[model samples]
Target: MQFETCHIPGLVIVTPKVFSDSRGFFFEAYNRKPFEEAGITANFVQDNQSQSSYGVIRGLHFQRNPFAQSKLVRVLQGTILDVGVDIREGSPTFGQHFSIELSAENKKQLFLPAGFAHGFSVLSETAIVAYKCDNYYSKESEGGIRYDDPELAIDWKIDPAKAIVSGKDLELPLLSESFANFTY
Candidate 1:
């Protein structure tokens, strides 16, 4: 496995070496040793998966400090425009976001540390995304920033007219009004 850091600290892009034969291909998605060597020591405690149709946008969400989670996300099928935003207070990159295309073919993954908010938009007909989180989820600790926050100005790479977002997500606060629970 190879780990590449993004402009935002603690955010990493991971590429796994794949072996292919006449029948199929194989790669290790997560291995403790290599991850620790790469400076990602997240002890994942929960696994989550979701499936969405094209244009479906999921989030810009995070949990408060006590329930904060670091995640490793990858696509199991189809493709998506995955996004991560830096929200850690006092960090130089706070409010900036990073976007990447993840697909079954590319076999790439994004690792987002606890201080970031995460979201994705489906770019294919359908997509199945899976992720590992370092901490368990807490409903009371949940918080989010609006995906379309003008301050963040994230280009979800989808037509706004056709974008599908949940009412809950649409009601999330903007970056400036979001809950402050992280510090650099």
Candidate 2:
């Protein structure tokens, strides 16, 4: 596996070395030693999966400190535009966001440390997205930023007129009104 650092601190793009033959292909999805050596030390304790169709957008979500989570996300069956926004109070890239295309074909993953808000937009007919979290979820600790927050100005790749978002996510606060207790 190879870990590539993003311009934003604590964000990593992990590419696995896949071996393929006429029969099929294989790769180690997760290995503690190599990950730790790469400076990605999260001890994942929970796994979550979701399915969405093209035009569906979920996120800009995070858990408050004490319940904050570090996540490693990937697409198992299709394609998506995965995004992460830095919300750490004192970080140089605070309020900035990064995005990448993850698909079953590429076999890549995104590792987001605890201080960022995360989300994704399905780009395929249907997508199966899964992620590992270092901490369990807590409803009381739930927090998020509006996916269309003008300040952040994320390009979801999907046309806004056709984008499908849940009422809950649509109600999230804009970046200016959002708060993050985590600091760099």
Candidate 3:
């Protein structure tokens, strides 16, 4: 397995060793010992999965301090443009974002530390995304930046006009106006 850190501190992209045979392929998606050796020692406590169709933009969300989660996310059955933003106040890369293409074919995983906000857009006909979280979720701590915030200007790839978003997400406050709850 190879672990590559992104431009932002604490964010990493992991590539696993895959073996293929006549029938199929296999890889160890997660192994604690190797992860710890790579300097990632988060005790992931929860697992979450979601499935969405083409052009669906799920989030640019995070939880405040006590409930903030570090996530290891991967695509299970299709393709997506996964994005993470450094929202840690006062950090050198504050407000800077990174994106990567994750798909079943490539089998890549992204590790997003607690201080970042995350989201993904489906690029295939449909996609299944799964992730591990280091902390439990808290409703009161739940927060988000609008996926289309002008200042952030995230490109979902699909036409924004044709993108499908939940009413809640559509109404999420722009980065400028939301999440004073996050800490440095």
Candidate 4:
């Protein structure tokens, strides 16, 4: 596997070296030793999966303080435009985001360290997204930035009219308001 650091200090993109044949393919999605050697040693405690249809948008979300989570995410069935935003206050890239295409075909994964917000837009008829998190979910700590917050200006690659969002996501605060207590 090859790991590339993003603009943020601890965020990374991982590309697994796949071995393919006429029959199929294989790759080590996760190897603790190499990941630890690469400086990602988060002790994952939970695994989650979700499926969404095209035009569905799911974030710009994170957990606050003691419940913040670091995640390793990938696509299992289709494609998605995944995004991670640096919410860590005082960081040079705070409020900035990294976007990438993740698909079953590419077999690529993204590493979002704690102190960031994550979200994705499904690009296929249906997409299966899976992720490993260093911390368990905490409802009380859940927080998010509005997906269409002008200050952030994220291009979700879909028409606003066609985009589908949850009521919670639609009610999220803007980046400025959400960052009041953020720390790097």
lDDT of 2 by residue, 29-50 (tens): 8899999999888999999999
Give the 10-residue window scoring lowest on summed lDDT in candidate 4: 175-184
1-184 per-residue lDDT for model 4 (tens digits) = 8999976788899999999999999999998988998999999999999999999999989998788899999999999999999998888999998899999999999999888899999999999999999999999899999999998899999899999999989999999888535676
Candidate 2 residues lying further than 4 Å off, grouped into runs, are none
List where candidate 4 sits over 4 angstroms from the true fold: none
Go through the candidates in order and give each one's C-alpha lDDT.
0.96, 0.95, 0.91, 0.92
Predict model 3's lDDT versus the native.
Answer: 0.91
Candidate 3 pairs with clashing backbones: none
lDDT computed for candidate 1: 0.96
The lDDT, on a scale of 0 to 1, for candidate 4 is 0.92
For candidate 3, write residues 18-103 as lDDT tens digits: 99999899999999999999999999999999999999999888998789999999999999999998888888988888999999
Candidate 3 least-lDDT 10 residues? 175-184
Candidate 4 clash figure, as a count: 0
Q: Could you estimate the TM-score for every candidate? A: 0.99, 0.99, 0.96, 0.97
2 or 3, which is superior by TM-score? 2
Clashing pairs in 1: none
lDDT (C-alpha) at residue 114 in model 4: 89
Ranking 1 against 4 by lDDT, winner:
1
